[model samples]
Target: MPHVLIVDDEPRMLELLKLYIQPYGYTCQLVDSAQQALDLCRQHVFDLILLDVMMPDMDGWTCCRLIREHSNIPILMVTARNQREDIIRTREVGANDYISKPIQEGELIGRMEVLLQQQYDGLSYDRESYRCSYLQQKISLTKTEFELLGVFLDSPRRVWTRDQLTTMLWGAEASVDERTIDSHIRHLREKLRVCGFPIEQHLETVRGIGYRWTHQ
Candidate 1:
């Protein structure tokens, strides 16, 4: 069973989420404040977190940022609005996914499963040999390509802007063109495709923004 941390300021909301999640075999611990949630997170081990955005002491964005500093555990933000800005902010803060308020049980559980599956299945990397494989098949990549993959996998589903990618790949002072990031992504896609993985389906292009690896 997966262990989940459910955080919301509303008592009823926390209970509702717990009810919806527990039936699916996930064990949950509920907290009514972001700070309490953060404190528990530091002291416990959880498979995933269902975090509400409108907490009193600390907003979900700040909580998510703080969590990302030390953990790569899946975080699914629960928010009242589904506005584009909210979605962008969700990614910027490093959440794996988000669900709008008045949450549908099916949608919530499906999203949770996808995030968890993405965390454990389909991909594996060997740090010592610098090798990457999807579904047990090895795919070759150049050093730059390997690092680019690292960035995407580090924060899967987080929208990574070209400026951010450029800075990450080659320091802020380096004169690397933003388009170089695109070229590397293209090459990465080709290699993944050659290995028979559905690279294009999950490694997405955000067009005006950049890229994010997502199960959706």
Candidate 2:
């Protein structure tokens, strides 16, 4: 079973998360503060962390930063604050993903599964060189390209809308043109092609929808 650590200031919130998560076969450890979460991190190895932003003693952002200093464990920031700034800041502080409060158990579990699977498989990404592995060949990537590819590879065959891609690459507040996402995808596909990966076969457009990476 995958181990999960849930950090939240509210007891009810923690219990709710546990109730939802445990049924899905995850073993959960709960903590009420960021400091306690950090302490637990030092003592245990967890597959993922569900962290709340507005905790006492130390905020999730600080705790996230501190955790990243020593570990790359997948962290999903849970917050009632849905502002674009807050969402962007979660990424800045090294969270793998963020979800607003009134957590949807299905979406929460889906995100967790993605993060955990990516970590377990080491698919696409090479942390040491900041490169993406395709077949036996490895290609260097810009940070944006890397992140974009991560989104695709993390959920192969799932169509991601342009608006979703824009928000992902440039935070929700960013005013990025949809055309910009097209340009990035084009560039990313070209890089993969140059590296001998068959981009046309795998990276596909969905007419009015968006893009999907289909792993053959």
> Could you give candidate 2's per-residue lDDT for residues 1-216 as a string of tens digits?
678999999999999999999998889999999999999999887878999999877999999999988877888999997898997898899888999988999999899887775552223465456767654466777899988988886676789999999998899999988999999898998998897766787789999989998644
* Candidate 2 least-lDDT 10 residues: 119-128
Tell me which residue pairs clash in candidate 1. Answer: none
Per-candidate TM-scores read 0.58, 0.58
| Total clashing pairs in model 2 | 0
True-structure RMSD, every candidate: 15.9, 12.9
Residues 106-134, candidate 1, lDDT per residue (tens digit)?
A: 99999998776555334656555787877
Query: Local distance difference test, per candidate?
Result: 0.85, 0.84
